[model samples]
Target: MTAAPALAPAALRVRGVTKSFGDLAVLRGVDLEVARGSILALLGSNGAGKTTLVRILATLLAADAGTAEVDGHDVAAEAPQVRESLSLTGQFAAVDEVLTGRENLILVARLRHLPRPAAVADAMLERFALTAAGRRRAGTYSGGMRRRLDIAMSLVGDPPVIVLDEPTTGLDPQSRLEVWRTIRELATGGTTVLLTTQHLDEAEQLADRIAILHEGRIVHTGTLAELRALLPAAPVEMVQKQPSLEDVFLALIGHDGPPATAPSGPTAQETAS
Candidate 1:
């Protein structure tokens, strides 16, 4: 029998990845693979160590055990290669407040040693719809605009793998949608993206594969269809009637309402003891 053709190298791979802080174990034998030219969403509640995992992948932190690779280069042994192939947007947008949006982009471009920093910065501002505000200080921009500039800075080197950690956290709905469109376009253009987000809808919309990180370990990983199929189907409620009080409340408050319910059973702490 003929063997199957060797699979193309994955964009990123983590095997038995584990991390700890003294007595506290954060990541416990987590294994994940993100394929080239796809979006992999890492979903979890706050304090689930999603950021920790991304840090390891981005070469910001060292794992206590197991192995990680980016673009066929071992993360530990080939740190520079991994860094060169990956871009990470931290949970908080990190634009320099003192710098104008254009200056920020140019600075990053220069750091990446782009041949023409001004041209590259101009192109990025145009691509991210920030050309209008490019001359303003990042501190003066709206949250969404600042976030967009922060993301634009990360693309200076055009890394193949982009790690976006909650890139849309403070954006308005329209801004969030715009970010989603940009993410989808990147994935379609053959860039692998690994993202961590609490927004389940965003994951369902953009991720080719979804991994639910529960207590640092991946409890679920699959395509949206596969993950959704695991749960009982519930009717999506869209009303032709006038907006309900809840909708009106959210509209007036400019925020999603309080969470609907609490966990039904014992907490993880109770379960562990």
Candidate 2:
């Protein structure tokens, strides 16, 4: 795809995207928009069709109805072009276990036909802070390191749009934080990101906006503050301010960055139908 999105004020646009299998419907009618260089979290629960919708946008699956576009390329008609404009990192780390971390990066670089794949791989390894583990088999790396390497590989071509589906689902607290930091850095560097998550705190911490997908439709769309306004503040009680788990976790780990404002729960709770 062309770099039109960078200067054309483009966005990841989805309109009435729907899908189904036999009699079971997945995405009924979903719509969302992630602006250029910003992060939008598609908040939902299991069976919410978030993955199905993502697959449609990624051109891995065809939609029964509606359309999706990125950087002026239609997902159906201009699939190849749309692909050029986007990068996808799924729910799990898509790394080669047998390959070393550096080798994994080099493999992706070569697939993208980047010049001097070794140099590109070296840069990626250093960027993800995996230089020391560059020679280690990816399967031997810690969960956080493996996730970082996966993300690093995804960014090789610097696709203007990226879709990450529950990137930190099974990670430990520290590893989750590391992946969170990486995602924030991605948006800060001007890549439009669309990520799906069940965690409310994740949406609060990462997204510029949140779209709560429920029963196959977007029931609400807004920033954390806006969504929080939907529910009245917790009675403004003069009660003790107990530190949250996230607060405790960060304090114990000394992690630097904005702490998530949301309490732990499925993101669907942040909004209602």
Candidate 3:
């Protein structure tokens, strides 16, 4: 008898993916994979091509060369299937300010052709802790509320993969923590999440695996401890105390010391950077 086949594809896969704009090359032969129900964080400074790579995977921008797949569907050739498998939340909230939080989710559900759109909307509001604010117009919602509503709307399609590009930007400490909890819950619910963020602490807090993008290529990829091993030994003076997450991050990225902390709560979960 033939051997049993594997049941599911890698949640995401990319091979030598490249993108360019005239003389400027944004992605250079990028390769990575993410398993189902896990979180992979893509870390980079501004212009490191994190967003460009995400756009290619999301089918918002076509790659100039190489290939990508979402749940085994080729992003370029099977664009519709790729889109059907993934939901993208960009840096800015994408909900309609004029609509109530509930209405916003219902509209998204209806657009996705889900039956019982109102029911789906209500469920999402409750899941995101927006049930109490469901009736308020989104225009009057705080930044955090709008962000939560935006993410809830993304789930209306119930895709298997979620792509978040700087999803926590501009959120207050409590709001950031709330978003972090929501992200963790998504992974716990068996959804694959690919996140791009500049916050090193955020990546350390939540990523199962982390990839660093620099100069249009993936410079390194591994679990936090593995990445830390790539760094040179700290000076004896600096080693008098146990190194912090920021130390590992700075060491790997070749920075001198920790950057200024954002006005945020403690790291949501601890892991080596």
Candidate 4:
């Protein structure tokens, strides 16, 4: 009798993740989970320790006292497998400006030891709509195109999970939308994504579920509708204050610590550097 194939674990799983640098605590016992092929937007402002949390999940930085797993592999114990299962794109696109778009993709493919790097790059260029710009130096590409190419490079090995921290930070609205469409397509292909962004509308647009991180803790997490359900029933005068999400965030989270260390929430790596 043939044994049934084992079930794939949750695409991303994190529990009690805490990170501190000197006197500053960056993440305070964060607990979260993301299912396979879903997009979870981690919404937080500039000093909310979002980048610190991302680094921990990607194995780029270790947590002080907690465990995290990617694709069922423990992040700390199985760093190699965890990294292989996920690709990370930080606030800025990690592409070589001097290299042509094709060269950039091929370089990453080779780095990953994928066979036929040229073929892999070509496929990725096509997949990301960069085929027309394949031979152009990445620096010459527009903001959106460069970002797409960066993402294409990350996809060269088809990692099952992708971590994007502020992927649309500096893009025009149209460029932002273009990236949004690309993200949507990736999820459709069964790729799991954990995206960190401060933009409320972006969260509404791209996430299957939204998690709001405040002062090193997840204050709330749920589907857009589910999150909306947390609000008091509408009738402006009845509630008194405005119904903005900022209001809701503060309301749900309560008045916590002073939004983490100020001036853009530096991670331990940043401070050590």
**What TM-score, over all chains together, does every model reach?**
0.84, 0.88, 0.84, 0.83
Candidate 3 lDDT score relative to the true structure = 0.87
Candidate closer to the true structure by TM-score (higher is better), 2 or 3: 2
| Candidate 4: residue 103 lDDT (0-100) | 96
Ten contiguous residues with the weakest lDDT in model 1: 264-273
lDDT of 2 by residue, 1-273 (tens): 655544564578899988989998888988888889999999999998899988888899999999899877899999998888888998889999999999998899889889999999998888888999999999998898999999999999878988999999799887898999899998998989999999887888889999999988999999988997998565332433566787798878887765555544443332222
Query: For every model in order, what is the number of clashing pairs?
Result: 0, 0, 0, 0
What tens digits encode model 3's per-residue C-alpha lDDT throughout 1-273? 999987777899999999889999999999989999999999999999999999999999999889899998999899999989999999999999998999999889888999999999999989988899999999999887888888888888789999999999998655676688789999999999999999998998889999999989999999988998898765432212344565466567665433324345443533333
lDDT of every model, 2 decimals? 0.85, 0.87, 0.87, 0.86
Off by over 4 Å in 2: 1-9, 246-273
Q: Cα lDDT for residue 70, model 2?
A: 87
- After best superposition, candidate 3 residue 99: deviation in angstroms? 0.6
C-alpha lDDT of residue 233 in model 1: 60
Clash pairs for candidate 3: none
Best by TM-score: 2
lDDT of 2: 0.87
Per-residue alpha-carbon lDDT of candidate 1 for residues 146-198, written as tens digits (9 for 90 to 100): 77788888878888899999989877665565677788888888889998999
Candidates ranked by lDDT, best first? 3, 2, 4, 1
lDDT comparison, 2 vs 4, better candidate? 2
